[model samples]
Target: MRGELSLVADCKVVRFDAAFDITRETIGAISDVTLARRDAVTAMRRAFAELNGADVPIICLLRNTSENGLRDAKNLGATCCLSAHTPPAMVARTMMTQVIQDRADRPVRSIERGVARATEVLTRLFDGARSNGPVALAQVDASLEPIIEAVRDGGLTRWLDRVWTHDDATYQHCLLVAGVAAKFSLHLGFSASDRNHFVRAALLHDLGKARIPLAILNKPGRLDEGEMTVMRTHPVIGYEKLKAAGCDALTLGAVRHHHEMLDGSGYPDRLSGDSIGDTVRLMTICDIYSALTEKRAYKPAMPNAVAMAILSDMKGRLEDRLVQSFGEAMGNGS
Candidate 1:
């Protein structure tokens, strides 16, 4: 009751214009409705009354709801009963759409605040190294904790979508890569230690980009040879930066070699297929996929199918077996 009261009252709203799982008694969402406690139902009634008869747009998970609870929910204004299996992102999207439809206003600023804070942290990490020298490696890990936690917590990808902004492509790209890499690592049956190493690498793979000028990085036009040459140095630069900060060999390898191709055509080392380790190969696949799918000033975002096709065509560049594995894991088939 206190939780609901505080949320509804503190927000100065009568109706809690959000979806929640009754079973969990937590706001934002619940996975099961049938498991909702009787006390929770009573609390909902009190919350509605506190709104002075305003219709609360309570969202319930229908699959778990008992018939009695259903009666109570309808009486208490739980007008939207979503499927229990609906992804939280989908639920948020659906609720937001309905809230907008009903002319209910909710502030999206909170989500934006989180993204803004993350962007600020990344900006500082990048800028600090440039102006002052090496920031503590621990600080780097701490700064990235929220994003890592969000990915681990599940449904964060969808939640992130609710709050996504176009403010910083670099930060967004890193987050996306981390999430995607984590999923891929899981698919490949990577041990927890190895997965952690992989995720950290994905997050910091573009650390060298911090040194690159924004003009070239954000350029809408194709890079000239000189600009391309400069851009290609990011891997080496990142490798040096992380190495200076005392990151492990696996992490450093990922940061430096993510750009290396299997055909001996890659830069900084040009190590061919056999020379590239499994981890680097994995990082390469993640890096290429993330880059291809991302929208840039110079190009539009490609569809997943197109991106996979291009990856497939890069037989000499990326490991073919890993590419096939990636496609299979992504449900597109190799």
Candidate 2:
């Protein structure tokens, strides 16, 4: 199969201080990045200078909405500005249907609507949804389906392997990982339910880590054996948490067994062979791929080829078929 590129559209990664509504904007080229607290012109000039010779669509985002968003973008050679408040889902859909498709003059009103919805959700979450107005997790869960539809093809995993892959907190990272995993599931010819399960697992696979001590969870160095033992409890912790939170069997399976391997080398349970089903297997593969490709305090993200090679060797330690498919996809990507 030709490798499908699902860029980030819907899974608005909100862990950072800055984000964008680039779901609709094509990235031809991004040059020098300039930050502006108030001056969009200065930022634009730097971006313009960076792409002086490159002839491609330039993309950038601002921290907050400035009156100069459009004007500054025009001068900076930016096709779009994805600010913190941009609607990720709308940006994704527009990029898919228009920018990526090379259509002209796509409607802006629809994108604005997407931004509005995203902002609303973001406000509720950051506003302490649990204790304040008490927004249900299901409400936030509803938001994910739309984002998933938008971001799976925007090259979220592939584009960030440069010098520094950005790191967001757990929840945002989960959304980003799920975006790529959901796309991978579709490419694998999984059914709608299957795809949905992957999306859910991808988003919540790390939920157990929330229980791990912060020292170990965010540790910059490799964990010691005792710390490793505590880390292994994440699967169980995550599974119980999800079960309590009412996650289904499929999602629970992924959360529980995402670490297990075919040859019986993984954690939680050294599940091997057919015991490791396709969905969990796929999650395992996607998890490794996403982690290696993401920026982290521990290490830099690996290149596609290098990560695949490591995965290939680990197949003896993981499931063979999943590794094969992952390798094929990586080759197709390259």
Candidates' C-alpha lDDT: 0.65, 0.58
- Residue-level lDDT of model 1, residues 1-334, one tens digit each, is 2244343323222233343233222233222334366665666655544332332345666665567757766676665677677775666666555555533232233233334545665666678656747745665554344443444444334424532345467777776676567667767888877776777787788988888888888877689999999999999988888788789998888888888888888878888867788889998898888777776555666777898999999987888888999987655221
Model 2 misplacement above 4 A: 1-137, 157-166, 331-334
For candidate 2, the 10 contiguous residues with the lowest summed lDDT are: 1-10
* For every candidate, C-alpha RMSD to the true structure in Å: 12.1, 14.3
- TM-score for candidate 2: 0.58
